[model samples]
Target: MNPELKLVAARQGGVFSRAQAMAVGYTPEQIRERLTGGRWERIRHGQYAERADLSALDAWEQHIVRHRRAVHAAMNSMRPGSAVVSHHSALVLQGIPVWQVDLAEVQLTRTSGRGEVKAGVRHHQGRLSPADTTRVDGLTTTTIARAVVESAARTSFEAAVVSADAALRRPEVSAEDFRRLLAVTECWPGSPAIRSVLAFAVPLAESAGESRLRVLMRNEGLPPPVLQAAFNDAAGFVGRVDFYFPDHNTVVEFDGLKKYADGSREALIREKLREDRLRALGLEVVRVTWADLLQPARTATHIRQAFDRARRTRLAG
Candidate 1:
């Protein structure tokens, strides 16, 4: 590629438009020849990226890069601030984690007048205050709090909590921010559901998988356990556990099942020692994994049984 074309691609995130190619001294005919010869690939109408194997990148990464290009493709022709990225699109821009979100279209919100409905963009009438919008990477987007609520209002409860918990981890967003988001979206279609998740949301959840397990356990009728409960014995503090049932002397460990695969030998040994300490205290440990989470009822049943066993074991001892 020529110097100018390379510069243009670099500025445009490895993707450029036909107009960019032309400005870089390539004629329309030359662009067509490049496309025909497989030297470039069309990501969207008028949006092209150099033809290179993307097998080195994972599918999710490739998806994000293409989404960014498509978003740029949509924004390249849009008026500044007139089309602000919102909803799930804003979540992505804010670096928030997402699961079970629709990534098929780049969503935009009108900052002023009704935004034009473009072919590849989903436009919403989001008359947001300056406080509710943020600029990320030269792109306008709804604030992280607003984006989290907007997305939560449209997704399943578990998925929304995952997002909400993740958003709460950020210093910019807070519980009050969540309340404000809920208040503003009060009349929205999914407001009640979103509010419920917000009410249940906690910042202490360290992972989406943990948030999800909490939701599952609640929905299945298990008594809500205190989160990150600290344990102590005569020696010293045992450790903080994911969930603790003080009433029944039980501890529920939420494992994503990924930890078992990655934690080194020393980490595994330390974890086992921690469990042994908890068990020595006569606290029955109930482990919940991804598979257990899928069958919430069964998991709840096992937990109840553990609760009973712990109570009986403590009495016997």
Candidate 2:
């Protein structure tokens, strides 16, 4: 790998923007020819990554590179307000799965000018400061902490918390850094998201899906569920539930497509058998998918209804 490619790999597989290319000694024509010859891939406008190992360009890697390049290009061409990447761009840089998107947009602070800056790119105006910002791949971005807050702000309360917890659990980010980042957001617009994230994003950092469901439940004012609660029976360890409420005997399972994309029938069958065994243990299990995450209100309602039914069964027994 060349020095540039090495740098990109260090950045978790980033792509180069046109401005980045110019800074690194590649002209627009050279970039174009690289794309034409399949030497480089155009992930988004003015963004290019090497096709040296196309297989390595998984969806997450490709999306992060494209977003990074887009943010860099936008910042280079921006006026009035300096663009500091936020939301999905920040999550991508932090290697979190908050918003899965291919396009990248430069999120500007409130001081940005009113006119439209670019096509196919989004500009988010918010309160920001120098302390909560960093430079990556030649683009300004909200620090990992700020990005976690922004990601949570865009999500239901619990989802945000889970993402924040995950961000903090990463060795690159520390609890102290998260607090410092939160302190700076005191004057930031949408501080509710920041505060809520700070309060709930903790405590369940080890459980991926629990906090997301908890946030949704909290948004609906439902009682918080237990995390990693296990059930035992004569048939050995039944299974582990992502979120469980002992009183209601209800469970929530978060599923990511990557888990099953391997296409193993035996694995799939084993998973199903586990679910069946859990159901047989008199647990009312609810499956939460990515789509349900997008519709949190309905998901919360569904879970609440399941709890009601489980309560009735428990009372009868």
Candidate 3:
């Protein structure tokens, strides 16, 4: 590839259009040769990227990366400013964590025309005011608040809450912003569910696991737990917990890999010590892992058992 095409591909998330290759002095045969030789990978019709640019990534990360490249490719294929990236695609572009949302199609919103899906892109027909859209990484996309609401309207409640919680953590996003967007999209399909998501979303959720656990607890009819609750003992601040059931005197921690990324003995020992301190403070510690979340009923049972034990211990005292 020439310097010109290299620059173009770099600007578009390592993707380039067929026309761009030609413009940069590559013949169609040359492009075909590169594709056949496994040097260039086709992102979509008329869009290609160097295979080397698509590095090995974990399943989730790779999905996001492929979706991002597809988004850029779709944008490149369309006329400039014809559509803005919206919905889950916008959330991905803004680096917001989304759970269980479809990334198979790049989502775009246009000011007019009926919505349609074609060539791995979904175009949504909606009114996007200036306030509802912004530029993320040089691509026009719906604002975080707008994106969250749009996504919530189309996905499961659990998925919506996860994205909404992450979006709320952004300084530029607020509950008011979501409410305003909600008012605009009030009559749309699934608006009520979006409303519920906004009401449930909190900026305090520090990770997707914590957010999902909160949703599961609600769905299972468990009492709402205080998020990121701090516990102190005679030694000082014991630690901040993921979820705390004040009435039950129990602490629920979402044990995701992020907390134990190092997987070191010392890290495990420190966590054990932290749980011991919480126990010393008369709090029942219940740990929830990603696997536990997959079985909501079992997880809820475990938490309830902890609650019962804490209550019994208190009564015994």
Instruction: Give lDDT for model 1.
Output: 0.82
Q: Could you give candidate 3's per-residue lDDT for residues 1-317 as a string of tens digits? A: 78899999988988999999999899999999999999999999999998864366668998999899999999989888789999999999999998887789899997666699888888999888899999986789999999999998899999988888999889999778977887898899878998899988999998999999999999999999999999888889988999999999999999886757777888889999999999999999998899999999999999999999999999999
Best-performing candidate as measured by lDDT: 3
Instruction: Sort every candidate by lDDT, greatest first.
Output: 3, 1, 2
- Least lDDT summed over 10 consecutive residues: which range in candidate 1? 72-81
State residue 268's C-alpha deviation in candidate 1, in Å.
2.2
Report the lDDT of model 2 for residue 279: 80
TM-score of 2: 0.68
Is candidate 1 or 2 superior in lDDT? 1
Regions of candidate 1 where Cα sits further than 4 Å from its true position: 1-12, 33-39, 51-62, 112-120, 234-237, 260-263
Candidate 3 accuracy as TM-score: 0.97
Best by TM-score: 3
Global lDDT for candidate 3? 0.90
Off by over 4 Å in 3: 53-56
The better-scoring model by TM-score among 1 and 3 is: 3
* Residue pairs in candidate 2 whose N, alpha carbon or C atoms collide under 3 angstroms: 158-215
